[model samples]
Target: MNQIDTGLVKRLIGEQFPEWAHLEVKPVKFSGHDNRTFHLGDKMSVRLPSDAAYAPQVEKENKWLPILSKELSLPISTPIAKGNPSEAYPWPWSINKWIEGETVTKQNVRDLSKFAAHLGSFLVELQSIDASKGPIAGAHNFYRGGLISVYDEEARDAIENNKDVFDETVLKHLWDLALQSTWRRKPVWIHGDVAPGNLLVKDGKLCAVIDFGILGVGDPACDAAMSWTFFDKSSRKIFKEVLQIDEETWNRARGWVLWKALITYDANKISNKIVAEESYRVIQVIVNDYGR
Candidate 1:
């Protein structure tokens, strides 16, 4: 992952697609961790994988985004051009049609409950789309739609290491609850990283989803993680009703949120206070919600 500044983007565009060589290549304010995104003029954006681990997502999105876009009403990332590997950059990249709207946040949304329900419905539509030919959960998408058990050891280690910081007994109980069942029905599509940064809103309404680096077809529980990570009790209830997931699946979803938060907490608790606090807060939310 080289420093993905405007200059590198300029050279890549200039060498590859000379037609848009002169367009201003500026960094999007919230460019994500997996990919380096820069606005390619007004209508499009250039996204390059930030590391080898994320490089494969460019091709995966290029193949499936258009098909998924057709089935869902909300705008997902749409690839307009596939950039080749050049001397300026090593890995293949993408030129996507820029979707408008800022990333979602509690302060920015007009009505929290409505936003939650709306996002839930959008996810329902995404799941309903045909995924017969879609990629199964694996390393490419970080096993998002697969079993939360894939990271069992890592999650356990995080919890054990942070026992002094977190309630070990409660965290262990939640972890066991997650392994209670498998996705019994047919597999469905999932937006692996359904976080605030990936969701987009305009004029206080959720309108688009971006950054499908972890997109895959499998257990929908991974997508349900936002229920605890992002939403409050009332909004979580509305969103849950729309998803209509059963208790067993919901338990797995709880596990999905807990696992990530545990690891995030373990990694950042010392150096980054804000993220650590939020991750701890998310864990407590899951704990309290389960207790009731």
Candidate 2:
């Protein structure tokens, strides 16, 4: 694990908010693979990239998060600067008004109906945001370690190299299904990673979503695909109804799940047992349905 210099984090925050100089600044650990997030009192926060590769997308969030906060009604982290002094921070960074909430858990899934309504309203509001004015141009071609072509022959070379961790037959099946089901519809702005962790719950209702670093314009199904991560069939039905996803979009959503599952399996080859198991589960569900 690369060590994050909390001194640098403190220095950056101190420079960004000089008035809060005496407020306690402590480093807090959060679950995420890409960006570094920290709490700032009860009403604000800051995030920095652990990987330099995401610098561009980090900048995009700095530019577009405010627009989404304004025109869209969903709870979002609104960017606030210390009175136009944003450039004071060393790398591209943004300060967000602290949204009070907690990460929805697996137990929360039992209340799928309530979660569905919250998630449904959020997606509907997100899809309503006009894509024409955002600073981001098109698909987030560079996010997710920039592996948009998840099934390219060359892409699977490492997995092929180590045949033990991956099943060649299952991999091939998922690849074929994904390629055949690629999107044919018009692209729109999407919150690319709508996983449960990004969702915020307060008072038994979803209050807001954070982590816009993966926001982009793409097949809206990329957002809907999260159903596999956070919802079951009944809850997903409510999700689909709210988003108005059609048959083709459903296929593309399935493709999104397959590609993301493969990526997760590949990246966590050595570290996470849970990710590997979940990847198999996603594949099983997809293959069973596709076989039907």
Candidate 3:
């Protein structure tokens, strides 16, 4: 996909949403792989999916974020206007009420354990919402909230291919543990992607969560997977305790984290050095914790 620059964004907004076209369109500092986000003046954000695969999330977020926001304790991205495809931009896009906070990272947090508890509380509340009609786990969400076994073949392939970097025996053990349990309970709402980039911090506290592009209803274990990616041993303990996650769920969460890290590290090791390194670090965390 071609990079979405400020000029493209400005032209799209000017064509589709003439009212807001007059507002300054500046590129946001941290745009993710799935979408290009730009700040529209001081109050709104413009988000355009980088490709067709991610385009569907525009409608999904538009349709569900308002509903989810009402139920969630923390602030969420609220779509203000939906943009249609034009000559300049082909994919559907969204204008959201700009959230005022910095994306949370490990270094910026004042207290890891407390932050974990805050995040855990938010997830508990989100899961408690009525998700009877929410979207089910499937390809739309990259099979998140679905069975971890869905990625078993791919994970095994990654393990085998990366034998020089990982221990085949230990990776197999972790994979087996993840496959041993299924989500026996009723499905619940899961945030699908809960990495630090999706979390916002203000006043040294977790203030809001954004990017519900992968939101769905299914095994809550997917949300629990962030415990490994974002928290340390002490903070992870607090996170599990606050959420009251069971042993089976925690094991499955480890599987989810391992699967993502393994595939991500393998796929991007040479092409994208930064993500590869980060994914490698997460893999190490999972292995070290599992070993203990």
Candidate 4:
């Protein structure tokens, strides 16, 4: 919905695939905090990076998508065309195969029991995939970085950029609390960001999972945080049975939700007051339950 240039997109398409010169470019309203996405008809998608800082990750996404798609036994929008991605464009651009479906929300996730079953089945399928096949080089940081290291850099960057939206004292206190939260064993491959926006549903069933930008090997707790987003206690118990996660893993998952919630506010000023307030609600749960 923002001011997107249609002509530039057409030019890029022509440059990448001169054979598709006649195809019309249409804008899709879907986007995330990191990338601007457009649907190129029913079978292809085009993405332009939101910021130069994300170029490296965009590059990684381009490489990893096809690799993981083959391994996950699921549908994915693999890149077809790419731009040089220097100062001229400021950020990278990629065209991908369009994946169709609506994102899952609380409305779509109505039958909590069924939804939990679906999630459990999906996680089992995801975990069964051989990690050795899609070995993502340069992705070791994600598994090991954890909250303690991520917040250190985030705080340092906030200070350097003079983006003092959060008070330093408050940020340090919150970061300390998040670090002290119980973290489980090393990691298994995780979605990293498993919010409602990334999951797709159709006809009351989960059809596809998108947004692989944060896809990496990390704490399974990262994905388990989805329990708070949808599953209630009963549904979550069912989820554990279907996925075969033990109680110790479940506890770490609860810790992950709190830890991820706390570290986020230390860096950026959330634009939506409602979301900020809701995040604080989740933060309070983490503090009372896990913060020692």
The TM-score leader among the candidates is 1
Error of 2 at 216 (Å): 1.2
Quick one: best lDDT, which candidate?
1
Query: In candidate 2, what are the lDDT values of residues 57-109, reduced to their tens digit?
Result: 66677678877888766678677752222343334755668777778776644
* Cα lDDT of model 3 by residue, 47-157, tens digit: 999888889899999988899899888999999999998777788899999999889988789999999999999999999999899999898988889998999999999
What would the per-residue lDDT of candidate 1 be over residues 25-66, giving only the tens digit for each residue?
Answer: 999999898999999999999999888899899899999999
Alpha-carbon lDDT of model 2: 0.65
TM-score of each: 0.98, 0.82, 0.96, 0.74
Q: What TM-score, to 2 decimals, does candidate 3 have?
A: 0.96
Off by over 4 Å in 3: 1-3
Candidate 3: give the clashing pairs.
Answer: none
Candidate 4 displacement at residue 9 in angstroms: 2.4
Question: Candidate 4's error at 172, in angstroms?
Answer: 12
- Model 1's alpha-carbon lDDT is 0.92
Score residue 132 of candidate 1 by CA lDDT: 90
